[model samples]
Target: MTVRKATDVFSEWALRDRDEGMEEGHAKSVNDMLKMVIPKFTSPFSVIDVGCGNGWVCRYLESIENCYKAVGVDGSKEMILKAKIKGDGEFHLAQLPFWKPSIKFDLIHSMEFLYYLHDPFEMLKIFYEEWLKPGGILIAGIDHYSENTISLGWPKALNVNMSTFSENEWRKAMLDAGFIDVKIQRVGIKEGFVGTLAMLGQKLN
Candidate 1:
């Protein structure tokens, strides 16, 4: 019997959540990253969102006054289809650790997507080396990190591979990935839930 991959299951789950929109309670954490990130753009910038489920964030980034282009790529074809219909970004269906963009981006963002990789730190290195231009910024928003007890069962429950790294471990990974000034900040705290953590990194020449 052939077994289905965990990513396939996650794709199906995300497709079901497509119509819910980013206004859902769980998405508010990434909204805080958006607040902090959008203002830092001094010039017209291009963005690529990795694992951009439903493309809501891509749509919002495109609406920004200084945004030149916003592109979203996800592994789920259904999610990309829904994003095309309900959101306003160049959405593409691509599997990661292999898909390479035609052009590098000034900003690369991923919300709650990195942990799904078996070795998220290696993916971070790949993103820094291939996806981001020099001086570009990459922010990974994570809710299922080691510190977030609320998400301890996510891997088992979803039957997916999740790398539960500590806050400092994530930082060290970013720094080791040739990113400078790596900083991990917690955002969007709500009662009874661990706040989202933003791993911010910059590629400086």
Candidate 2:
């Protein structure tokens, strides 16, 4: 599916179901992303959440002890509106693959968002160069990874364009995008769910 159509479908879903539209499995992935990074914030930090549905993650980050600022960017206007209504943070409506942040953040976090892009690697490069400050961390959680057999049919099942790759491929993409110390992890498994593949990398000076 083209970016336009995908955005429309997601926006419609958000308008209809609000936060509950996000699947429980995907919600766990977001929580895993948060748990993995929250302890890393030793000092006050700024964050930009990519594909931040309902801005719940941003709100959670803002509630952290050293979170100086939390901002959410999403392609769905209705999602942003819902976020603005109940979330405590700055929210912006912008397409993930084209969205650019004016201010670089200490951390760039994305959950279940990278695969929707036509070129996930290109998006990683953008986050590395344009959205993250030097030494900043970029963490992404993906449930539709290639290694997860249960999600192999996600593209056809969800009727969306998704790019699936091995965990190693994801780590390499981040490294190629100028991130150092790239790493990957599998987190939170339960019945009928394969869990989330989390990829992390940090911009180097």
Candidate 3:
């Protein structure tokens, strides 16, 4: 079976209002990632969520005490429309590795996203080199990795192309992007569900 591009699949999901379910379904794992990483943010921080779907993460980031700016970007127009409809944060349309924001952010976050890219490592490099300020943090989380046996079939089930990667491969990707002090761990596991693989890296200048 041929795999569809991720943006096409997700744009269809937005049209069918499946984006709402996405925010609900991934809330737990995304929240766990937020909790683990939020405390590290300094005051007056700015954030950008790549592949932010409906902008749920952007909304939440805006609510934090010291979060000054929160923005969400996705390749799908429908996904961006849904995020704008919610009216909490800035949302934009962009295809990754080919797009860069005019302003760099203090934190960059992505969930259920990186794996969809044909070249996630190159995207990570863009984040490090263009999208983040010195000392900025990049946290990427995904459920569809090699260890999550359940997610192994997602490519066919969802009909979208997904990169199959191991935990170590992901860690190496971050390190190779020139991010320092890289760390990788699993979060939000539940009975049969293996959990999301969360990775973090910082730009140390």
TM-score of each: 0.92, 0.92, 0.96
lDDT of 3 by residue, 1-205 (tens): 7778789889999999999898888888898888877899667899999999989899988889999999999999999988998885789898886788999999999999998989998999999999999999998899999989989999888888889999999998999999999889898788888889999899987
Better of 1 and 3 by TM-score: 3
Span of 10 residues, lowest total lDDT, candidate 2: 1-10
Cα TM-score of candidate 3: 0.96
Best by TM-score: 3
Candidate 1, residues 133-181, lDDT tens digits: the string is 9999998898898889879997777667778999898988999999998
Model 2 per-residue lDDT tens digits across residues 1-205: 4434566767888878845657454677777777877787788999998888888788878888899999999988888888899866799999767668789999998888889888999999888888898889988988888779988887787688888899888888988999888878887777877778888888986
Model 3 Cα displacement at 42 (Å)?
3.2
Error of 2 at 26 (Å): 3.2
Q: After superposition, how far is residue 127 of candidate 3 from its true place, in Å?
A: 0.7
TM-score for predicted model 2 compared with the true structure: 0.92
Global local distance difference test of model 3: 0.90
Better of 1 and 3 by lDDT: 3
Root-mean-square deviation (CA) per prediction: 2.0, 1.9, 1.2
